[model samples]
Target: MNKHGIISLGEVIVDLIATDLSNTTFQRLLGGATVNVAVGVSRHGIPSYYLCKLGSDESSEFVKGQLTKEKVDLSFCSYDFNKEICSVYIHLNELGERYFHSYVNETPDEWITAEELDLEPFQKSKLFYFGSGTLFHPIARKTTEQAIHYAREENLKIAFDTNIRLKRWESENQCRETILSFVQKADIVKMTEDELLFLTETDTIETGLEHMAKLEIPYLFVTRGKDGAYAIHKNKIEHVPGIPVNAIDTTGAGDAFMAALLSRFHDNGVPNNEAELTEYTEFANKAGALSATKLGAL
Candidate 1:
């Protein structure tokens, strides 16, 4: 909490990815959009801090151990005996495509409150990264909102990733409305092509980018899997080609790209010109493509 680095607040979950179509055999991996970004940033030699409420269950212990092993700072993290870490059962087909089969949680309503958070970490960190995963829960939403306001008040750049999970929200309209509200407050925002279309209610990617450009977001990226990504700033757009790889699993590729991009920003500051934007995007593209070649997110 006293360190200066990237700070992220959200749920820490374990993904039970199926090894076969039967869905009986599985492999447990530390999984969450925010967690992946934190670990990836730490691997880039940046001190990363995580804020969450952990428990004593096996899944919770596993999450704590993995975060510690990855060298993520946990001074801002809390604990609760009654709570339990969330678990997601994912199904993978022969082609390595993943599907969220079901979700399990013992205490979905229990969450760390905004009053429990310390503002010092936000003051010290260079950036604040958040996603929509925890926003569906009212209790967790308050904490996320507080952290965002604190980061803005302190003049730290805010990064928002619309990591949308429709299953968690009551309706698509609610999810869209809630996410767009946060998107307006971000300095840097990232989303997949599908997310861009969904948020803007546009039929094509070009119109979606155009719609987002009107929001005046300083930095915007729309990732297109193996095709690469697009970077938009000040209404200027640049397409950065992606690195091709024989992807076996694409679990955390976007998180990898996000971490690499933020790491570059932390080390060299945000890209101001077209050339600089392409350079940073190219660097992140490689990281993402490489992650897809592996079996796990970490």
Candidate 2:
């Protein structure tokens, strides 16, 4: 196996996005934070692998087809015959903001175990990516912990997104603690301003970053909706303003940002210097801005 690519482990689900609020029209799109990142990396012509569990159903087939079409390696995707497919009902506000109603109570993606994971790819990959949401379930949580340990042992660069979904966790404190633990493990950590507030228990961005800096997190990127994004390394911080666009749906913009950031890092051989980091962050911010211009989760 090649040790120069990326491996993303987490959930993948079908998104039923409402096309019209006035009517019952909706469009089903294959999306999950990890899944979207995989597709985004593939679209950027990077070698990528998606590690997840899918049900033996139509939604599973649809997801597989999309992964195949995008040229993402799905050799590690596990399938379970007993469980139903996972899905999310996305409702968009008039301002283009989105909300979700998840139908993943009994889905296979919530059942990924440590024994089911093949750590060979994690050992070989240059980068390993995962989000905080998958750590909610016991089976998937154990699998994630195992994978992170293996990646650390192999000296693979780990990137984590603090994609905190409040509805999925048992309690706010649990989510914060769990996500902070994972953040401590990551070589690069990405989170939105709101997520940072939740994680650090601070109201302002300066105080939030200060709190995270105390954790000794080497690299941190804070995204602020339409305002822009901020990147911090060592003691230096840089802010990149967001591009203006008529966002019809802000569904996968953050995932797009992460994918582009990782893809750039992967392409640049995981920069070891400040100059390289700056270059990558600028390019990644642009990729994220472009994603917001589109309607779907692409």
Candidate number achieving the greatest TM-score relative to the actual structure = 1
Query: Which lDDT tens digits does candidate 2 get at residues 14-89?
Result: 7887787642567889877998898998888888899887777788788888899999998877768865657778
lDDT of 1 by residue, 81-126 (tens): 9889988899977787788788899898878789888888888888
Model 2 RMSD in Å is 2.4
Clash totals, every prediction: 0, 1
Model 2 is weakest, by summed lDDT over 10 consecutive residues, at 101-110
How does candidate 2 score on lDDT?
Answer: 0.83
Give candidate 2 misplaced runs (Cα > 4 Å): 19-25, 91-104, 108-110
How close to the true structure is residue 11 of candidate 1, measured as C-alpha lDDT? 86
**Number of the top-ranking candidate, with lDDT as the measure:** 1
lDDT of all the models against the reference?
Answer: 0.90, 0.83
